[model samples]
Target: MKLINLITPSANLAELSSIASEHDLLLLRQDAVYLVHKAALPFPGKVLALESDVTWRNITLPASIRAISDAEWVTLSANASQNLLWS
Candidate 1:
């Protein structure tokens, strides 16, 4: 899946809500936490949210997002297009 990540203040969610609608996925980040507002996972696949060097247990996200610890499985933004080409 191709995800568009935006690091904006929590107060900006109102203004950035349109961007979330345009992208296939949306990742909102503030401080050291990540919130998954939308996920474009293929059927039968899963979405995982991982944050390195930070404690994300208190972060609130949709139940659809699966939290993970290891970084190896997280998809890199740089390789997203390439991965999608083959998808």
Candidate 2:
């Protein structure tokens, strides 16, 4: 199943890794966007960050993290077979 994981806080990397699977998308927003600067997410799945949030916070998301527009975010969420929000 296509899973989308929305991370809104700074989650533990190990915890994330433990649950992560291939191609499970992870979207970072709010405080969680900070993770991109510190390090790429542990998950091997696709990683995206909210563009505006990163811009407003002045966090330069790394190359490993793709920046997604609002429309893209909606599309991603909508396409997911399951949506999991982790705060």
Candidate 3:
């Protein structure tokens, strides 16, 4: 499965949604963690947010999005078939 990392709040949702599938994983980090506040996620896949980022921003994540640690982020990247970054 692909691991798609979003590092900015302005990352193109349309472009991301076009390439994402249910088997993929979408990781929200840095400013991208703000996406969890949106009404709905653009990706049709499992969504994970960096716990520290969310906490730093003082934003509470929705039930649909999981909050993961830095170690878990590394593990997810290591296990994925491909890693893609979207700024």
Candidate 4:
């Protein structure tokens, strides 16, 4: 299954990038204004959007960011973050 991670500003992007498996899709902001799918891990998994460049805002992230996430928005801790972003 594919997972879409709408990361919060407080979360760590670097860690997720390093270990994330090549099966997840990351959709985030790019111009620090809107969202973009930056990179991908591998086949069946892709990392989309530039995490560092994007601006982190609750409003912009949730609703206007990526067409409103239909899946459950899981609040992941630093540890669990890896699973959500990478796993």
**Candidate achieving the largest lDDT:** 3
Worst 10 residues of 1 by lDDT: 78-87
Residue 51 lDDT in model 4? Answer: 32
- Summed backbone clashes in each candidate are 0, 0, 0, 11
Question: What is the per-residue lDDT of model 3 for residues 40-87, given as tens digits with 9 covering 90 to 100?
Answer: 987899999999999999999899999999999999999999999999
TM-score pick, better of 1 and 3: 3
What is the C-alpha local distance difference test score of candidate 1?
0.41
| Order of the predicted models by lDDT, top scorer first | 3, 2, 1, 4
- What TM-score goes with each of the models? 0.39, 0.83, 0.96, 0.32
Tell me the lDDT of model 3 at 42.
76
- lDDT, candidate 4, equals 0.40
Candidates 2 and 3 compared by lDDT, better number: 3
**Candidate 1 backbone collisions, by pair:** none
Write one digit per residue (lDDT tens) for candidate 1, span 1-87: 455444433435444344333334443333423435434333223344554412444666567765444443344554454232110
Please give the lDDT score at residue 71 for candidate 1.
49
Which regions of candidate 3 fall more than 4 Å away from where they truly are? none
